[model samples]
Target: MIARSTFSNGIVLCCRSDDDDSLLAVKCIDIDECPTSSLVLLQHEVALTRTISHENIHTYSSVWLSKSRLCMSSLFMDYGSCADIISSHFKHGLPEKIMALILYEILTALSYLRSVNLIHRGVRCSHILVSKNGEIKLSGHRNMIELSRDGIPVKKVHDFPKHDSSMLPWLSPEILQQDMQGYCTKSDIYSLGITACELANGYAPFTDMPSTQMLLEKLNGTIPFMLDETTVAPLIEDTSPSANADTEKFKSEMIEAAKSRKFSTAMHQLVTDCLERDPDMRMDADQLLKHPVFRQIKGLSKCQILQPVFEKMDPISKKASARVFQEQEEMMDELNRMSMCDVEWDFQE
Candidate 1:
C-alpha cells in the first residue's frame, strides 16, 4: 500500500515514495472542481510532456484517471527547484560556471520546444529543477502553448486570467498587456533573462518594491535595481580591511566580466533584450542559442528531447499564439520607433 502525505487540489501522496526512487510526481486533478477549459489544458500539458523526452525537459511518466481524480505522471526531481537553492544560498550567488551550465540546459530545452512549435510561457528560475548530479530540467510544461494544430490553423484562447505583473518583471511587455498573438518564443527568452538575473543576484529584480510600483516603473521603461557602481562595489568588497587591493580589483573585474550588452554573459543584457519595450527586436530561442555565451557551454546537446502530450491540435492555443504574436509585433515596432525618437529628441531637448 502507498502512503499518502499531503493532499490538495485532488493531489495526494499515492505511495511512500522517497526522493530517490524512479517514481513520478502524481497530481490527482479533479475535473469537476477545475474549469473544463483548464482540465483540457492540463491534459495537453501531460501529452506534451510525454511527447517530448529530453534530458533538459522534465519527463512525463504517465497519466491516468482514478474515480473522480485525474492523476498526472511526471519525473520526480529530488534536488527541489532553483528557487529553493537561491533561497537557501541567498548570501552568495552560485559560481559562474554552474550558472552557465544551468542556463545552457534551459536554453537547450527551450530550443527543442521551439523547434516543435511549443512555447514555455513560464521560464522562471523556480520552474527549473536541478538534479543531484548537477543536471538541469525545465519543469512546469503545463503553461506551454502549441503554435499549430493538425493542418488547419488553430484558434488561440485569449480568455485566460491575467497574472500579477509584479511576480515576473522579466516578462515581455506584450505578455503583460495581454497581447496573445504577440506572445511567442521570444516571450520565453525574456523570462529566461529574468531568471538569469535572479540567479546572479539571489533575488528577483525590483524585489524591494511593491509589485504595483514595480509594474508602473517597468511600464515607464525604467528597470529597477540595475547594477551600478554603488551596488556592485558593496556586493564585491570584502569586509576585512586586511584584504589586498589587488584582490579587490580582481573582484571588480569578475563583476565586470559578468556584464554585457548581448544577453550573453551579462544578465543585464539579457534583461535588456528580453524586456525591451519592443518585441520585434527581442531575440528568439534559436537566436539566443546562437549567442557566444550559450555556445561555449560544455555537455550541452542539440537533440530534441521532449514531445507534446496530445498529437491532436487544440484550437484555443493556435488562435491565441497568432493573436498574441501580431499584437506583440505591432507593440514592439511602435515601442522601438518611439525609443529611437526619444533618444534623438532628448538630445535636442
Candidate 2:
C-alpha cells in the first residue's frame, strides 16, 4: 500500500502494483469494526456502481471478501474531492473557470443518470471526486433512487433521502416541506445549484445556522448566490450602541469581504436558475448543461481547463501527499503489532 486514510466506517488504501506501479484506491471495511447496516450499504454501493457506465461516474473495478475484511477497489483519484481542494488550496473557493469545468462534468454524469431513470440525490462537493488527469467523477451512490418501478414511471417521490442533518443545506425546499406534491429530478437540480454556490463561495449557505433555522431559511425562499462584489448588499448605517448595531457591523464586514472578489453575470444567473424556490421553475440537468456559464470552458479538455489551478496547487498537493505517507507508515507499524497478522484469506475480483 502506498498510503492509507480512515473514513467513517472503514479505511481507504492507496495501493500500487509491484510490477507496473499501477495505482488503485481500495476501500476496506474490517468486518469486526463495521456495523452490519454500514457494511450492507457499502456492498449495495458496489452493486449499484458496477452497473453504471459513464466517464464522469465513479464505478468499482472489483469487490471481494478477504478473511474478516471486505474491500472494493477503483481507479485512484489523486486530487480527491473538490472539498479537499477547497480545504487545501482554495479556502475561499475555486475560480469561476475551474468551478464551471467541475459543474460541467457533474452535469454530464447527471444527464446520463437521468437517461437511466436515476436520481443522484447526493450531489455535493465531497461526493465529486477529481483525479490528477483532470477527470471528474460523481460518487456517493448509496442514496441514489430510481424514478421508475417495474417499468412504470413515477413522477414524484415522497420518501426522504437517508442522510443526516448535514445534508439539509443541500436539500431542496420541496423535499424539506414533505408535502403531497412530492419531488422529482428537479430536486437534484436544486442541489446542484447549492453545490455551485458552495464551489463559488468558501462555505455552504446556512451552514452557520442551527438545523431548524437552516430548514426555515430554505423553506422561506432564501436563496444562496455566488459571493461577489455585485451581489453583496450595501451596508446600512447604524451608529447606536445596541445589539442591532453589532449585527449591522457584522453584516458590513461580510459585505466588504464579498466585495473583494468579482464574478461574471453568467455565474450569478446560473445559480439563480438552479436555486428557484419552485421546482418546476428550476433548470434540469440538460438545461444547465447549455447554460452560458459553461461557455467559458468551451472546447477545452478538463485537464487543459484546470491546468493553471493545478499549477498553483502543486506545492500544497506535495505537502499533503507527504503527510499522508507519514501517517500511513505509522498506521502500518501499529497494525504490524496486532495479532490479526496470522489471518489469511481468499481474494476475488
Candidate 3:
C-alpha cells in the first residue's frame, strides 16, 4: 500500500513491495456504468499482459477488483510516454538515425505481440513509454484486440463499433470500412506507418481536423499529412536555423537516395503499403522487420553512426566492418565532389 490520489474516473497510487516497485495506474468504473462485456474485456487484457514477457513491454504486476473500482498495476517508467519524448526532444522531428532506432524497437515489440496473435488496435505515440535510458516499452496493452484462429478479430463487445473508425486516425483502410473479413496482422502495420509519420512530423496526421472530419477525409482517400524539408524549416527556424538548414538538406538528399535504394525509399511507401486500399498488399510485422530499410540501417551502424537501435542489435547484425569502411570512403568521395559546387534552395529556412 502507498499514497493514493483520485482523478476523473480513476485513481493514481504509488505501490512498493519487495517483489515490485512501480507506479500503479488504476481506472475505476462503476460496474453498472460500463457494459458487462467491457469488464470482461478488461480482464482479458490483464490476462494477456500477464502472459507476455518482453523487455520492450511494461510488465503486468497485479489487478484488484473491489466493490467499485478495477485496479491494474504494471512496472513504472520514470520517463513519460513517447508523446512526451516527441514534444520535448523531437518537436520538429528527430534525426533519421534516432528515428530508425525508435521504429526498430517498436517493430520488435509489435513482432512479439503479433506472434501471439494480438493486434495493438491502438498504436500511437501516447501508447508508448520510454525508460530512463531511452529504451521504449509499448504500454496500454489493455487496448489490444485479440484475434481468432484465422487471424480475424474476435467479435467482442469492446471491439470497434461498426460505424466508428474515428477513434484512431492511424487505423488501416480495411478497418475503416468495417471489413472484419479482411482485418489481419497487416492492420497493425498501417498503424505503425502512421506512427512513423507522426514521429517525423511531430504531430498526428491531419491533427487540425476534428475526429469525424479526419475519418471522413481518410475514407475519401485523402493523403495523410507529412512534413518535408520545406515544411520543417518554418516550424523549427526559431530554434536553430543552421541546424534546420542541415536537416532540410539531409532530408532532400535522403529523399533522392531513397528513390534509388529499393529498400530505403521514402517512409511513405512502407506506410502506404500498410495503408493499402486493398489489404492484401500490406506487410506483417515480421515481414516489415526483414525489409530492405532495416538492412540499409544495418549498414548505417557500421559507419560509426551511433543510432538508438544500433547498440541493442545482436553482434552478428552489427558486424559490417568491411562494408562500413567502404561506405565511409564512398561518403568522403561524394562530399569532396559536392564541395566544388554551389547549392541553392528554392525554399527559405
Candidate 4:
C-alpha cells in the first residue's frame, strides 16, 4: 500500500496512492474477519463505484477481498465535502452561482445514473465531495440500486441496514411508507431538493428532529426546503410540504438566521422544481439540469466552474486531507465539523 490509515469503526483503512507527486489511487479497507453484513456493504460499494463513472463522480479502479479484509482502489479526491465549506466558510449559505454550478455538476452525474436506470438512493450534502481545484463530485453509493436489471429497489424497510438511517430526511414520501413503494430516480429528485436546502443554509431542514419524527415529517410532506432567512425563500417550501411549524416565525427565523451566502432566483427555482411533493410531478435530473440557473454555466468548462471553489476553500481542507492518512474515520468526522476542505483529488490523469 502506498499509504494507509485505519478506523475504529468496522471500516479499516483509507489511503491515497501517490506516484510522481500526483494521486494514483484511493484505497479503502474494511476489516470484517467474521464475515459480517458490513463486509457485504463494503463490497457492494466497491462494485457500484467501479460500475459508474462521470467527470463529477468518484471512480473505482479495482477491488479484492483478502481472508478478512475487503480492499477497494479508486481515484483520490482531495476536497472533502461541501459541508466542510458551509461549516467553515459559508455557515449561512453558499453563493448562488457556486451552488448552481455544483448542482449542475451533480445533475450531470445524476443524468448519467438515470440513463443506466439507477437510483442514487442517498444524495445528501454530506456525500458531496469537492477538490481544491473546485471540482465537486458525489460519493456514498452505499444505498444505490440498479433499477434497470434489478426490477425494483430492495423491498421492505427491514432490508435497509441501520447505518443509513441518517438519510431518512432525504427519502421521498412514497419510500417512507410501512409498505414500501418502488423508489426510482424521482425519489432521488426529492433528495436533491433537500440537498439544495442544505447547500443553501448549511443544515438540512430537520437536523434537530428525532429520527422517527423526521420520517413522519417527510411522509406527511411537513418538511421545508431552502428556507434560508436571508435569501429569497422558495414559494414551494411554504405551499407543498404540509407545514408543521409557525409559518410566520419559520419564515421570520430563517429571515433572521445569519444569511452569509446569498444565491439567486434561478437556483431557488431549481430547488422548488425538485422539491415537488408528487414523485410524478418532480423534474428528472435531465429536466432540472436544463433550468436557467445552470445556463450561467453552459459555456464554461468544468475546470472553470471548479476554480473558484478551489480558491474559496479554507486551510482546514488541506489539513483534513493530510490527516486522512492518520485517522480515516476522524477525518470523516472532521468533514461534518466544518473543519476541512479538498483540492484536486482526482487521479493525475
Candidate 5:
C-alpha cells in the first residue's frame, strides 16, 4: 500500500496491483463497525455505479466482501481531488479559467446523471476527483437519489441523507427545510454553486459556523459568492484609537491582494444563477451548461485549458505525502478521543 486514509465509516487504501502494476484506490468498510443503513447505501452505490458509464463519472472496477470488510476498488486519481489541490497548492483557490473548465466538465456529468434520473446528492470539491491529465470525474455516489420509481419519474424527494455530517453544509436549503415542498435535481445545482465557491475560495463558506447556524444562514437565503477581487471586503471593526492606522493599512493590503484575483462578470453570474434560494429559480444542469462563463473554453482542449493549473501545482507526490501525514495526525487524534484503543502510539519525531 502506498498510503491509506480513513473517513467516518471507511478506509481508502492507495495501492498498486502486483500483476498489472496499475494504481488502485480500494475503499474498505468494516462490516462490524458499519451500521445496517450504511451497508445498504454501500450496496446501492455499487449497483448504481455498475449501471452507469461516463468519462466524467467514476465507477468501481470490482467489489467484494471478505474478512468482515466490504472492499471496492477503482482507478486511483493522480491529483486526488479539487479539495486536495486547494490544500496543497492553490491555498487561496484556483484560477477562474481552470475552475470554469472543471465546472464545465462537472456539468456534463450532471447532465448525464439527470438523463438517467439520478441525483448526485454529494457535489463538493472532495467528491470531484482531478486527474494528472486534467480530467475531473465526479464520485461520492453513495448518497445518490434515484428519482424514478417503476419507470415513473418523481418530481421531488423528501428523504434526508444520514451518511455524513460534513455534507450538511453542501446540502440545498430546500432539503434542509424539510417542508411539504421537497427538493428535486435542482438541489444539486445549489451544491454545484457551493462547490464553485469552494474552488475559488480554497475553503467552503459557513464551515466555521455551527451546523444549526449554517442551516439558518442557508435558509435565510444567504448565498456565498466567489472570494475574488470583485467581492466586497467585510468591514473591519476596531474600536481602539491606537489600532486605527494599522487596521486601515491591513484593509488596504487586502484590497490590493484581491485586485489581482478578479473574476469575470459571467463567472459571477453563473454562480448567482445556480445559488438561487428557490429551487425553482435555480438553473438546472442543462441550463447551467449553457451559461456564458462556460463559453470561455469552448474550443480549447482539456490539456490546453488546464496546463497553467498543472504548471502551478507542486509535485503530486510531495503534496500527497504532506496531505497523508496531516490526515494521519487527524485520524489518530479522533481515534484517541473515542478511546476505543487502550494503548496509544506516539507518532512524533
Candidate 6:
C-alpha cells in the first residue's frame, strides 16, 4: 500500500500488488452501529457487483467488515474519467467517432443493468471510467435502484429522499418536473443523451445557470444540438472561380462542406431520440445499442487512442520523483525494522 486517506464517513487506501505493481483501491465506509442508509447502500452495491459480471462494470474482488468499516476492493482505472479529460484536454470536444465508441460501451453496461431491472440514476462524464486497455467501466452506482418485474419502481425513491443537485444537468426533464419522483429506467436514456452532448462539447449545456433555472429550461426550452455543428473547411479541389459559377455554385459548396462534417446524420437523429422530452418516446437501452452511431465505431481499444492524451498529462518532475524515492526508502527501512512486516523477499531494489 502506498497511500491512504480518511473522509467524513470512510477511508480509502491505495494499494499495489507485489507481483505486478498494478494499482488497486479499497473503499472502507464506516457505518457506526446502526442500520443506516449508508450500510444499506453499501450492501446493495456489493450485491450488485457480485451479480453483475459484465466486462464494462467494475467487479469487487472482496468485501468484508474490517473493524466497523465495510471495505470493498476493486480495480483502479488509470487514465482518469471523461470529465477529467475534458477539463484538461479536448476542451472544445472529442471527435464524433470517439464519442460513439464511448456511448456504445456505456449502453452495453446499461443494457445489462436493465436486464436486471436496475436503473442507474446517475449518468455523467465523471462516472465513466477509461483504462489503458480502452475498457469503459461504469462507476457511481450508489444511487442505483431496482424496479419491479414490469419495469416500474415499487417504492417512490424521491418522495422523502434527497438527491445530489449537481446531477441536474444530466437528469431528465420529467424527473425534475415531478420533484424527482416516479421515474423509471427510461430516465437513463435522457441522461445518456446529455452525457453524449457533454462528451461532444466538453460540458453539458446551460451549466453556468443555477440548477433550478436549468430545469425550467429543460421543461420549456428549444432542443439543443448535441454535437457542435461547425462546418468543415471547404475542399479546394475544383475551386477555380469560373465566369458562370454564381450563387448556386456557392450554395453547393456550403452543402458539400456540411456533408464533410464528422458527426453523422444518424448520430444526430439518435441523440434526438434519446433526448425526447416524453418519457415513453425515448429509446431503450436495447434499441440504443443498435443505433447507427455504434456501426461507425472502430475496433481499437481505449488505451490505444487515449495513451497519448494520458502521457501528455503525466509529466512527473525530477524533484518529485526524488522525493518519492526518499520516502520509499524510509518506508522500506521502517518495514525492515518492524518484526511484524511480512514483505516478499524477491522485491527488486
TM-scores, one per candidate = 0.63, 0.83, 0.63, 0.73, 0.81, 0.72
| Candidate 6 clash pair list | 134-302, 134-303
lDDT of 3 by residue, 56-80 (tens): 7775676777877776766555445
Model 5: per-residue lDDT, tens digit, 274-316? 8899887788999888889988888888878778667877545
- Looking at model 5, which ten-residue stretch has the lowest summed lDDT? 234-243
> Per-residue lDDT tens digits of candidate 2, residues 93-170?
788899999988999999998887788788899889988889999987877777876769898888786544567788
Between candidates 3 and 4, the one scoring higher on TM-score is: 4
The per-model lDDT (C-alpha) reads 0.60, 0.80, 0.60, 0.67, 0.82, 0.70
- Candidate 2 Cα errors over 4 Å, as ranges: 1-7, 18-20, 234-257, 315-349
RMSD of each: 22.5, 7.4, 18.2, 11.3, 8.5, 11.4
lDDT of 2: 0.80
Clashing pairs in 5: none
lDDT of 3 at 163: 29
Provide the global lDDT of candidate 6 against the true structure. 0.70
User: What lDDT is reached at residue 13 by model 5?
Assistant: 73
In candidate 2, list every pair of residues with a backbone clash: none
Q: Is 2 or 4 the stronger prediction by lDDT?
A: 2
- Candidates ranked by TM-score: 2, 5, 4, 6, 3, 1
Worst lDDT window (10 residues) for model 1? 303-312
